[model samples]
Target: MNWTLEVVVVPVSDVDRAKEFYAGRLGFAVDHDTDLGGAGRIVQLTPPGSGCSIVLGRGVVPEMPPGSLKGLQLVVADLEKARAELVERGAEVSEIQVVGQNPRPVPHPLDNVGFVFFRDPDGNEWAVQQISARG
Candidate 1:
């Protein structure tokens, strides 16, 4: 049996605002936005070139507070390019920082140590990483 991870539920205070941040600012593809009337509303979006999708909805994760989600990492082939794109789209991303097993300020041995970070409107943090060794 192949166990494939498909969707991740992102808790958001405002569904529409989250939708705008993901879809409009981040350029994620809006797969679906549906209202189940009594059930709730669901908004599914997929990042470009990604297999997994993220879902934002009302009552999706009632126990967890919005902005509690953190350390969601996005792998990119080119870190600088991706960070620039995010900035152009109006995201307040962090400057490129060096990351390694030790997580130091200086450059890592492999160029694989670079990372940039940003957060959604609800403060759900995300990290964009470049690991040439993985490719």
Candidate 2:
């Protein structure tokens, strides 16, 4: 059986704020924003070139706390470029650093070791890693 991951549910405190951050700052495409009346709101966004999308809803998963989601990673060809773009879009991102090495002013001397980090409006941490190539 072939199982393809479709969506990940991101928990956020405010729906509109989270939507704006994802769609506006991060430049994610808004797939849908639907209201189910008593069922609450469902908003889905798709990252560029990603088969898996992300969803956050008012009544979806109440147990998960907003800003608690961590270690979400996005792979990029260039960590510097990705971090620069996100910073230009008004997102505060960390400088490129080695993932599994000691902190330094400028790490990632090795290829495929570059990484940057940032967070959503709800404080959901995201890591952007630089890979020399991807298949």
Candidate 3:
């Protein structure tokens, strides 16, 4: 069985605002944006050169509980350059950090990639990471 991730539902307080942030700042393309009958609104955006998309909408069943989302993860080509680019783009990116618990490598370093965390206007945590390479 070949399972492919298609989309991720990103809950937001306002759809338009989320759309602007994703499309304008993050450079994601708007795929879908509309109403879901009596449910609510739906806005979907796709990242460049990727199969997965992010959906921002409302009226979802069992609407996403607050305080569940920790942050978003992204991958770039050049760690320092990418971080600088985001910072130049007016994004409040944080310093890079490695991930791990044991002392084997001190930190796994996430495939030897660099990662930085930021936040959206709504205080939603997001990240922009960079990897030397990807298969």
Candidate 4:
């Protein structure tokens, strides 16, 4: 048996607004926007090259305070490029911060140490880390 995280349900106040933020601003691909016909609506979006998808819904998902989710992380090959792309996409991402000591030095000192953070419209926090090569 294999355990894989295929989806994460993100709590949001407005499904449409969240959809726009994830799909329009963050550049996540909209997988589907389905209406359940009096039950609720479900919108799924996936990041580029990511197998896991995020779900934002109204009346069809778990109940949690909007913006309560935090510390969701993403790994990238280049922190600087990823930050730049996020900024270009209109997301207010934090400056790249090098935290902790690098176990092994890579071509870029920031590799394995560099990180950037941002929040969605509902304040769900996400961290992006640079990991060009994994040991």
Candidate 5:
């Protein structure tokens, strides 16, 4: 049987703040944002060209704990363009540092596939990677 992963619940300390970051800054589409009938609220966002969507809200979920992880990789088609846009959107993007098991500055082995890292308002480390397709 073929199975597919669907959702990833990112633990967020503040729902509204997260919504703004994921939606306004990163340009993720808010797929679902609503109040949970006085129980809690939910807000979901999907990055452009992303297969999985991130679900984050307060009290919408209980099991996922808030923490920081730096392993999430979101791929883009153009690294430089993505980095520029993220900066324009007010995201605190870090300078393009070396990546992979061994790392170095840009124009390195991964320059063709550019990448930059940043954090959400909650201090969750996230990366934006771009892979160039040579013509």
Candidate 6:
């Protein structure tokens, strides 16, 4: 048996605006946008090469205050490249910072320590960390 995290429900105020931010700005692929008629709408998006996907919806998901979710994280091989691409796409991302001491030896100094942060339109925060080579 495997406990896989296939989807995360991101609460947002406006579905269309959030969709544009994830798909257009962050380069996440739009998996599907389904209109549930009286139930609500569901929009699923997945990051490039990611196994997990995020679900955005109106009324079809659990009740959580929009923009209240935080500390969502992502890992990348190159922090600089990822940060640059997000900046180019008009995302207001934070500067790379060494947030903590690395637990294990890594190939690069920034690996496991370097991180950048950003937020969605509704202010749901996200962090991107450089992992480089995963052991």
Residue lDDT tens for model 1, 1-135? 989878888889999999999999999999999988878899999999999999999854455689999989888878888999999999999999986464444343435677999999999999998864542
Off by over 4 Å in 1: 60-62, 101-110, 133-135
TM-scores, all models, native as reference: 0.87, 0.87, 0.76, 0.95, 0.80, 0.97
The lDDT-based order of candidates, best leading, equals 6, 4, 1, 2, 5, 3
lDDT score of residue 43 within candidate 5: 83
lDDT by residue for model 2 (21-113), tens: 999999999999999899799999998888889998898556598999898888877677788899999999998887576344333363467
RMSD of each: 3.5, 4.1, 3.7, 1.0, 3.9, 0.9
lDDT of 3: 0.71
Comparing 2 and 4 on TM-score, the stronger one: 4
Q: Write the per-residue lDDT of candidate 6 for residues 1-135, one digit (tens) a residue.
A: 998989999999999999999999999999999999999999999999889999999989888899988988989999999999999999999999998788887889999899999999999999999988878
User: Cα lDDT of all candidates, in order?
Assistant: 0.87, 0.84, 0.71, 0.93, 0.76, 0.95
* Candidate 4 lDDT, 11-81, residue by residue in tens: 99999999999999988999999999999999999999899999999898999999999988888998999
- Backbone clashes under 3 angstroms, per model: 0, 0, 0, 0, 1, 0
Q: Pick the candidate with the highest TM-score.
A: 6
lDDT tens per residue, model 5, 7-110:
77788788888889889888999998989887888787888867788888776576554655456678766677788899999999988765555343443355
Residue 22 error for model 2, in Å? 0.5
Worst 10-residue lDDT window, candidate 4: 102-111
Task: Mark the regions of model 3 whose C-alpha exceeds 4 Å error after superposition.
Answer: 99-111
Residue 68 CA displacement from its true place in model 2, Å = 1.1
Clashing pairs in 5: 98-104
- In model 4, the Cα lDDT at residue 115 comes to 97
RMSD of 2: 4.1
